[model samples]
Target: MFSTLNWFGWALLSALFAALTAIFAKLGVAQINSDLATLIRTAIVFVLLCLYVAGTRQWSNPLALSGHSWLFLGLSGLATGASWLCYFRALQLGNAAQVAPIDKFSLVLVVIFAVLFLGERPSLREWCGIALIAGGVMVLAFKEQG
Candidate 1:
């Protein structure tokens, strides 16, 4: 099942797991500090990835990676950590439905950032979809006053 899977398949699986992460994290953080919850979640991810890499015989020397690879990956790791911390804190205080949609606002940012930093271009159609996602997130994030 995994052999023929492509990026979309992997992305779908990631989305499923991310949904579960919101539900689980909301419950897990109910009695614990959000920071500590993030720590535990990060540790689990670290261990799981380590084991998966080793089991798949994909381990490579850190020294073998290029400076560019190391720099970008390090920056990505820092951003992921910060995102997780904020996400967990938000989930702790907000409804999962609201928080998750707001968290997914990153998708809109990704498109803009990719165009600006990575020189990727999106078509008019793609921009329309991104705009819809942004609109949806805004709708989910803002509640009407009584």
Candidate 2:
């Protein structure tokens, strides 16, 4: 099943799950401190991923990985943790509709960071779509609540 799809399929699934996460986390944060809630969420993800890797026989020696891989993956993990913590806190204090779109402002940042740091060159069409995302987020951020 997983073999049939390429990146776009996986990205669509990720977006669906992420939307659910915002809704669920908002409800969960109501019952506990946001920081503690993030910790608990992180723990669940860790254990589930462990089981998934073990069940799939995908485990390998971490020491076998290159220093660059370790460095980048470690930094990515830190970034993910920070993002989750902040996302949970935002859900605790704001409407999911608003917070989720603003959170997606990261999409614009990703495109810019890719150009500057990763030497990526998105086509004009891609730039237009990215601009739309940025504009949509701004609209969501500033729209009057009637």
TM-score per prediction, in order, is 0.97, 0.96
Name the runs in model 1 displaced over 4 angstroms.
none
**Per-residue lDDT of candidate 2, residues 1-146 (tens digit):** 98799999999999999999999999999979999999999999999999999999999999999999999999999999999999999999999998999999999999999999999999999999999999999999776869
Per-candidate Cα lDDT values, in order, are 0.96, 0.95
> lDDT by residue for model 1 over 66-135, one digit each (tens)?
9999999999999999999999999999999999999999999999999999999999999999999999
Error of 2 at 99 (Å): 0.4
Best by lDDT: 1
